[model samples]
Target: MNARSLTLRNVNKSYDGVHMAADDVSLDIKAGEFVSFLGPSGSGKTTTLMMIAGFQHPTSGEIRLGERAIDNLPPHKRNIGMVFQNYALFPHMTIADNVAFPLRMRGVSKPEKERRSREALAKVGLQGFEKRIPSELSGGQQQRVALARALVFEPDIILLDEPLGALDKALREHMQVELKRIHKDLGVTMVYVTHDQTEAMTMSDRIAVFNQGRIEQIGTPDEIYFAPKTRFVASFIGDSNIIEASALGDGRFETAVGVVEARATGAERNSRADLLLRPEMIRIADAAQPDRRPFKIDTTINYGDNLLVIGKLGTQAIRMRVPGVDARRLTGSSECHVTWRSEDIHVIA
Candidate 1:
């Protein structure tokens, strides 16, 4: 199958003629790549997905599928497959018929439709459940059927809008793996939209983080987590402690805790900046170098795999994640020093 690229150029959508739902959003989704749109509600990810699916028209700018400008095309004419959070299956129809619906609508013959429907079902591990109705299947099974339906017509691209939101946590996690496997096997260009950070982190080749109708950053999972471009992207993608500080030049910053070293390549001296600290990067002072500063340990929470220690660092509350073994060694210590390498401190512009 030939996968086609999707492009949005300066796309903007506004309701009530003033506020923009998607502001100057430009993205190029490469053919056969899995990219995820991750953000909170009303962040314009869904609106952007709708525009790509031809369900919502952009107020201005261009949308192209491969070489053709598709901004004016109807949803049906675009030939894109879409999966919704609600499954959107025909409850009255058998699983086979539902999977064959798209092919039927395109005037496929009965024999070919049946063959393709069964083939799609087999892809989703639902080959034997074809005769059953949507009501007779479990949530995960129904979701698989929905995926089968979306893929039955062999679309050039597939758009999934929170397709796993309705399932339970364990089942949702299971489906994440399934989706990754399916994407790998089919090599179809897919654009997934979800509010779940873990889902995006686990399944996407790259992630586009959205905030307030604009894309804050777009990068690989590690880049988005360890090197966020903006404060919003840092706080949204994972747990982060953002500290306000003034740059002291020479890759250093002055904070309440003390003067700390950080990566501030482009930041000017004496300018205001924010430092991003991931809890896991900070180590207990005892386990690290002895020169690190000591802080009063206020409390600790046990998470089985790791211990989350919350404490005060020069009047500012901070958090550190210690490995279980290291946490056990400091069980009775009220004051423990914590330290992180200069490279671990991300100075957000």
Candidate 2:
């Protein structure tokens, strides 16, 4: 596949010319990079993707694929492959034909189309199923066919909009692995639009977090999860304890958790800040630790692999996740001592 970089410079989209579906959206996707546009519903992730794929026109600003401006190009003219959530395969056509549809549109010869279709199908692990119709294949297999169809033409970049959404949890997880593997093998530039945070975190090399038609942040999974710059990003990524605090200068804060300390980011004295404390960072206090907060247990939910303990540490409600081994010891207990390293606390910028 011929992978190419994608750039958007101040792209904006509005349906009624009054309300912006995508506001000043700009992104630079590197050649062969797998980037995900991730957000909650109505946050403009899909809107931005549609503009990139030429499905929706930007009211203002520009889009560039590699060195050329593609804002004026039609969807089919863009040479970008797209996979939809519904697995848009022809029901009556055999899997081989479905995979070859794009080639047929491009006027590829029969022998060449058959060979490329077979290779594409093999890349998605659907080699022998080419003779079967869509109805005869399982949801996962049908999705594979759709993926093969998209890859058969070897487009510059591929856009997938919630492609695994129709499958069950297990199948979806399995497909995530498969997609990552295929991406590694093909080295094609891919832009995946998904509302699923975990899906984006696990699959994408970089994630563009969207909210209210704007990009909140774009970074790697560790950077997004551990070092969120805004309250929205901190709260949306995963389990967190966002503590309101008053900066006390020199990286100290008066918080509900009491005198929380953090690395200085040149915070203004007396300014307000939000402290992001991940659930997994907190731990049951050691016996010798002098400073231990009294916790009142609210509930304990066991997931076999890990135990989620909801409780109150003084006035602030807190969630703590402990290893499953601790379940037997901590399950029925009303309260337990808790502590967290001050360095683990992140001050949301």
Candidate 3:
């Protein structure tokens, strides 16, 4: 199979001139890479996927698969495989027939079609269930059958629009691993669309975060988690304590909690900024470490696997996550000291 690189340039879409779906979006995807478009509902991720799959035409700009322009090409002529939120399987056909449908449409020989169908089912760990109808299979099994059908065509790229949306949490997590393995083994370009952050973080090589019909940031999981570019990105990706602070001219911040040392970059000195601190960065102060900042623990919550310690400093309350193993040590009243290093602070103006 020939793997193709996809590129979108200044792609825009709108419906009824009131809903601006995608706004001036441009992205480049490498061959044999798994990329996900991730965002909440109405963020234009699905619209962008539809445009790339040739199901919906962009209002402007162009789409290129390698050197060939595919903006005007029909959906079938694009040679792309697609899996939707719904399985969309034929209830009347067995799993084998469903997988072989694509090959038959392309006029492959009956023997070759059967061979490919069985091989595709085996690839998805559904080898012996090909004789069962869609109605006879579980939700997860039906979803796997749809995936097998998509792969049986041997398309250059596959578009998956929340393909695991219907499964339970545990099953969806398992399928994420399966999809990653399949992508690596097949070496086919895959563009996945999902609003679930955990699923995107677990499966994608890189993710493009969408908001308000625009892409806010595109990076690996760590980059997006630790080095968010905007305030929106910082707040949306994970839980963070965003506190307003004043840059005290020399890598120091005057915050509501207290004056603390922090790292500052790409922002002017003495400017107003927001400090983002993850819950795990703060730690309880030790008496042996006398130089650590002091804090007063206000509340402690047992979260099964970890203890969430809420503390008060001046008028502000901060949260810290402590391991369950160490939770037994914090059995005292609401009065514990806490501290954090200077490097854990993320400053966004």
User: Each prediction's Cα lDDT score?
Assistant: 0.92, 0.92, 0.88
Give one digit per residue, the lDDT tens place, for model 1 in 24-82. 99999999999999999999999999999999999998999999998999999997999
Residue 137 miss distance in model 1 (angstroms): 0.8
The number of residue pairs in model 1 that clash at the backbone is 1
Q: Model 1: runs farther than 4 Å from truth?
A: none
Error of 3 at 41 (Å): 1.2
Best by TM-score: 2
What are the per-residue Cα lDDT tens digits for candidate 3 across 249-325? 77888899888777856556678888888888877778877646666787888997889888767777777898888
C-alpha lDDT of residue 187 in model 3? 90
Worst 10 residues of 3 by lDDT: 260-269
So what's the TM-score on candidate 2? 0.98
* TM-score per model over all chains: 0.97, 0.98, 0.94
Model 3, CA-based lDDT = 0.88
Ten-residue region with minimum lDDT total, candidate 2: 323-332
